[model samples]
Target: MDVFEVVADDVRRDLLLALRRGALTAGELARTRSDVSRPAVSRHLRVLREAGVVQSVVDGRRRVYSLRPDALAPLATFLAALTPPAPPVPARALDGLDLEVRRTTRERRTAHGAAQQEESA
Candidate 1:
């Protein structure tokens, strides 16, 4: 299953959110969801595990689940490529303009009512 496909379900997404805090056994994950039964939650977890978004580790008799964040790398990379980068600042945008210096000089002259000596280059 595509990583995106597995996450399309709300339950699977919520399971991922819960797992983000830390690992939890299947029973614990199921308890966190009041709407879904344990069996249903297990199915959702199965999908997530198959999709590579979650991983399970057997601790004695308990099966612990945790999010596999690296699994989202492909999705993130796709999104970053989909969005265009900001246009680069034009190199010569203000090349010939000394408007800032001129404005400051004018403001100083007006506010002080006296000509200010220009700074030496």
Candidate 2:
């Protein structure tokens, strides 16, 4: 599924926004948003991890999560390319998409490297 579909949930958006500020533990994230339960937050985190939108590292007993930053680039690039130039979609919006794709591409590469390491280990 595309990053848009994966991030369609409100909970996921909140988590992503939080990560944008900096990395946080699951419990910290749960405390940041009361609309979603702690368990629900965990589930959402899992989904984001699977989508390569977030990365988590074990910090003692907690898993500290942060935005992947460039994980959504492939989707963003695909969408940007599909946008019709003659449709007046706004150059500003297209520029934003271009930036997003560049960022996501970096995250995608990092995630791939991590996955490869996991497989080797």
Candidate 3:
């Protein structure tokens, strides 16, 4: 099974999340959740191991499991590509309107000053 297929199950995903903190024995992983049986957790662990999503080491009688982060690189890259880019800044339409209004006011003031000077003369 590939990494996607292996992590498709919620129980298996939970098991992976538990292993992310550190290595844990099969029993320890099973105990992390109360809903699933130990055997079921073991089956999920087997799938994860088969997919290269996790690696196991025999520590005495127990099999300790830990996450293999490198195995998830492809999935991470795929997800990153799917994420939408940030929205662009909006155009300042009001700024141009404000400049036009100021120009019109300045023009009217200058015209009024010229008319007053002509009347006085």
- Per-residue lDDT of 29 in model 3: 97
- Model 1: which residue pairs collide? none
- What is the per-residue lDDT of model 2 for residues 18-117, given as tens digits with 9 covering 90 to 100? 9999999999999878977899999999999988899999999999999987998876788899987776677888998999999999999999999999
Clashes of 1: 0
Taking all chains together, each candidate's TM-score versus the true structure is: 0.66, 0.62, 0.70
Best by lDDT: 3
- Overall local distance difference test of candidate 3: 0.91
lDDT of 2: 0.89
For model 2, the stretches where C-alpha displacement exceeds 4 angstroms are 78-121
Q: lDDT for each of the candidates?
A: 0.88, 0.89, 0.91
lDDT measured at residue 93 in model 2 versus the true structure, 0 to 100:
80
Model 1 per-residue lDDT tens digits across residues 6-93: 8778998889989999999999999889899999999998999998999999999989999999998888888899999999978577
The best candidate in terms of TM-score: 3
Candidate 2 similarity to native, TM-score = 0.62
**Residue 12 error, candidate 1, Å:** 0.4
Write candidate 3's Cα lDDT for 1-121 as tens digits: 8877877789988998998899999999999879999988888889999989999999999999999999999889889999999787566857898899999999999999999999999
Ranking by lDDT: 3, 2, 1
